[model samples]
Target: MYPTNIKMKKKDKRKVAKAVRGAIKAGIKENIKLFLNTKKFGRIILAKLHI
Candidate 1:
């Protein structure tokens, strides 16, 4: 864990945010493949979710 007096620098914060975004993007991409293979009702739900 980080020390109480220590803080994450701006650059490190941006890097963490970017990594998180990439992971989320990958997860959504995987889900999209699964959604495409699902039934019509599942597709409608997926579309409603804006994915």
Candidate 2:
């Protein structure tokens, strides 16, 4: 029983770590999307100016 409990605790720790990693990845993706959108918008504006 004690061994099983220990194993469960380890699994929980792994799950928490994976969740944290996924959150970080999601944040980075969001930032990249925002950056790309802004860049495209700027390009469009520049084109309108015939630059």
Candidate 3:
């Protein structure tokens, strides 16, 4: 993946964008799951209650 910075053909533009978006979304999902295992979610709930 190091060479992903290389120029991609116009025909592959959408495909590459889709792949990058999919990868970023997947990474975010993983981080969210990991965070939920800690007490970060409790803080969010407490803040909501205070409001």
Candidate 4:
């Protein structure tokens, strides 16, 4: 019973870690995209840009 409890705890920890990592990655990607769009749009005309 003790060993099974320990294994369950470890699994839970791993799941939480994976979720946190994914959220961080998504946030970083959004920030980078926003930064790039802001910088690029500031310097170029909207008509010439291609996403």
In order of appearance, the predictions have TM-scores of 0.61, 0.59, 0.55, 0.61
Ten residues in sequence with the least summed lDDT for candidate 4: 41-50
RMSD of 1: 6.3
State candidate 4's TM-score: 0.61
Error of 4 at 31 (Å): 0.2
| Predicted candidate 2 versus true structure: per-residue lDDT over 1-51, tens digit per residue | 355534557789999999999999999977766675579785565557653
What lDDT does the true structure give each of the candidates?
0.86, 0.75, 0.77, 0.74
Model 4, backbone clash pairs (residues 3+ apart or across chains), number: 0
- lDDT ranking, best first: 1, 3, 2, 4
Per residue, candidate 4 scores C-alpha lDDT tens digits across 2-44 of: 5553445778999999999999999997786666668866336
Relative to the unseen true structure, what is the C-alpha lDDT of residue 45 in candidate 2, on a scale of 0 to 100? Answer: 53
Quality of model 2 by C-alpha lDDT: 0.75
lDDT of 1 by residue, 1-51 (tens): 766977899999999999999999999988886977587887777778873
Residue-level error in angstroms, candidate 1, position 21: 0.6
Candidate 2's TM-score reads: 0.59
Give lDDT for model 1.
Answer: 0.86
Number of the top lDDT candidate: 1
Tell me how many residue pairs clash in candidate 3: 0
